[model samples]
Target chain A: MIQKWKNHAEAYLFVTPSVILTVTLGIYPILWALRYMFYDYKGYGEAKFAGLYNIKRLFRDDYLWDAIWNTFVFASGKMILTLPVALLLAVLLNGKLRGRNLLRGIYFMPTIFSTAVMAVVFYLIFNSYNGLLNQILNMIGLPAVEWLNMQNAMLTCIIIAAWGGIGNYMLLFLAGLQGIPKDVYESAELDGATGARRFWSITIPMLGPVLNIIMMLAIMSALESYEAIMVLTGGGPSGATEVMHLYLYKLLFPVSTGETMAQDIGYGSAVAMLLALIVGVITGLYLYLSRKLNDIYS
Target chain B: MTRISGRILTWTFLLITAALLLLPIALAMLGSFKTNQELNAGSALLPKVWQLENYLYTWKEAKFSVYVWNSVIYSVGATITTVTVCSLAAYAVARRSFPGRKLLLGVYSAMMFIHMGVLTLKPAYQIMVTLGLHKSVLGLIIMMTGAGGTTFFILYAFIRSISKELDEAAMIDGASSFYIFSRIILPLCAPALGVVGLFAFRGAWNNYILPLVFTMSQPELQPITVGLANIRYGFGGAVQSHLMLTGACISMLPMLLMYILANKSFVQMNVGAIKG
Candidate 1:
């Protein structure tokens, strides 16, 4: 018993720092947040219980639906657009390309740039006036409009998100593509499943497992599109691109013209709790679906 | 046969996509060589006039030296600590047959969500205040470690791929857990560590949100990411292609070098991640 206890202490000590920080930050704060969610507390002071009022308020919120729809549309748009683009690029680059190595490094650049820096660059490039895109459009005779404003905020955000994300998924897809045994492709080709036929029959079907993970990752990131919004639009031009996570952030911070910062602390926590549950549930569903698909593939 | 045309089409498509991928970078690099006036009106493919002094101008006028130095300190400090701590924790989780292994792994998965998503702002502020970590580089470093648990999980997955025969042999020879970890396991795990370190370094260097919220108004403590963000606030109606391009190039240098050095392992490690 003593020897077993000694081993336990050693393991405990080894993982203690990470565990302590994780639990304090990871587990306890979450628990604290959950408890705080039921209260009518602002951020600076004590929290008071308000029953399910905060959650009840959540169901009637207009922006919640807007945020949810934006999140889904943004996430689905990227999954649909970026994944195939990444897959096609992965297949193209997986072949005997001369500059594959150089191209890989080039692709990784946007991914490596801090989100702040990426927002900075794209903000400049996609600016409504005198930015690169509009400037080019002027040369080709197209009138310019505010990209981050009411017209196409979510679309612009999705494009930016896809640009930042494609490199990551491209790399992941590249890894998945290369792992498909050359023998499988060779056999399929011998059976006259070359090129397009091979991709549909052999490449994609074989890449299914990896694709599942990649799709799930892309979707999860799409659901949590706060950083892009925070850095790029700040959900601006009259809340045109207000995603749920960003909305929750604004609730916590309270940046509206009239509302004080501390006024919505309790309200924000309730919203955050719901947001976490939604993100958690979506992620769980992806894992369950992917596992089922994985079993079928195997 | 369409083989010749297939090869041509492949090269053409990749080259076009590659050009699109490389646009901002190439423009940024070329802009670094142009005068302010020339940059605003210059072609995208090439600068109308070469004015390398823009590099010197921003380097001095913008105080990029301090920003770059601070970036180095935060990124390096965070990477060394995260890689060391995460690797040790991961080693224990992998090798030690503890009762809470499953629970610990679940915590690791949950860590990914809390570290960066909706909980990022509040929990970080709360922890920093409680731990007296507000506004200090080391505090930022600590939060960064927690932020990097996904990285730890990735490394753990890699470590699981190697056989346990070496550690088993070491244990038989009276090597202590720390000894076996430092000498045998850590050394063998260098390649994985490199991948982890690159990610940690890039993440630290590029992290905007944590540093944005955590650091007080001390400009001296600001990293390159924040410095670039400053450019946005002062982004008067004109295009500062020369300045933006120079900044992007400077910011990309360290990550670019690491990406080149570890490209192969990066790919291999990712393959391991998906397959597992």
Candidate 2:
């Protein structure tokens, strides 16, 4: 009993800091955010204990759903477009191609551009009057676009997200593609397994584990994205491209008439918690369905 | 017949994609060379003129001289402390079969499931407010130290891959655990340490959100990331494409230097991802 107790004590000491951090910074903030969900707690001042008020307000909130809808469309669009492109690119570059290092450097270029910077760049490209994007369109005799304005806002943001992101996925796929033993291709060639058939049968199976992890990573990243949306649109021309964090930001720092920031702290915290839960569920489901959980354990 | 065609198609597809990726960065680089009017009038695949002034102006413009020093100090300070503390903790867990070790590992891992910033910035601010670190870079360093431990913990998992016999040999050589750790274990742990240090560096360097929320008054103390964002806002969006391009150039400078110097190690580190 004494030995076991001593062991437990030592274990407790080792783990204490992490436990405390997770509680104070991780778990406690979540519950705190949850509690504030019901009240109208704004950033600066006193919040009323309006039970279920914020949650109810969320249902009646049109902008909340609009943000939700935009975020969904963006996330879905990223998955479909980014993955196959990354996979194909990885497969091509996995071999000895000309300018391989230069290509790798170039392909990974946009990712190195900070999202805030990319937002400015994309904003420039999509600008109407003197923007490069409009300049090209007009040259081709197509109508010039008002990119960040209402109509093209979400679509443009999605394209930017996809562009900046695809490289990281490609790298991950490259790692997976490299992991497959060359022997399989050698043996498959002997069996008259031509290129397409070999890829379908051998490469896919060999690559399953890595591809699964990449998908999980892609999903997690998609859900967690805030910077791109924040920089690109600021929840937009009448909240057209508003996302969860952007919406929370707006709620906390409302720019409307007679808006007192301090008064809405509770509501902001509530939105924060709801957003946390929504992301948590999405990630949890992805973790479960994909090979992430099984493969993660050491 | 299809096999040859497919191979040809693959190269074409990748080349086209690579070209698309090249477009923005190439534009940003050349944009720095052009005068503001030229960039606005008509920017294309190439710059009409080369203006090294954008780089010079950006350096002075953001006072990035100070920003770079500040960023280096904070990130390095956090890196040194975080690696030491986390490696100590990780050593204890990976080497010893003490009580609650599994439980302790589970608790830390479970914390990973929570959103990265959910409770972190808020309560951290509350604590910082009390510590009077609210607007200080030291406060940012400490917060980063705490967050920085998680990535190192992932590196810790990689440490488990090495055999225990290595530790046993050191112990038999009359080395104290401390001596053995610093002398033997730590040296042998270089690859893991390298991965952790690089990760910590990239994360700390790229970080903007923490500074944005935590400190508002100290523009002098701002890092490159936040400083670049401020430049964009200061310029006012519409007609300031050159200034915006200058901001992009400034932000990418340190990262580009780091990437070029460490590209091999960087690639190796990604392949080393255990928890990321």
What TM-score does candidate 1 get on C-alpha atoms? 0.91
Residue-level lDDT of model 1, residues B35-64, one tens digit each, is: 666645535546666777777867788778
User: All candidates' lDDT scores?
Assistant: 0.74, 0.71
**Residues B1-276, candidate 2, lDDT per residue (tens digit)?**
986897798778878888777767767777777788887787565676677777677667647677777778877977775677677667767776775678767766766655633334665687778889887878888777753235646656766877788878977886666676677678888877876777677767777767666656687778776776666555445555676687677767777888888776666666555233
Q: Native contact fraction of candidate 2?
A: 0.36
Cα deviation at B49, candidate 1, in Å, is 4.2
Question: Least lDDT summed over 10 consecutive residues: which range in candidate 1 chain B?
Answer: B112-121
TM-score for chain B of all predictions? 0.88, 0.89
Residue A125 shift from truth in candidate 1, angstroms: 1.2
Give candidate 2's error at residue A249 in angstroms. 3.0
Give the least accurate 10-residue stretch of model 1 chain A, judged by summed lDDT: A254-263
How does residue B56 of candidate 1 score in lDDT? 80
Poorly placed runs, candidate 1 (over 4 Å): A140-146, A254-263, A287-298, B1-5, B35-45, B113-118, B235-245
Candidate with maximal DockQ: 1
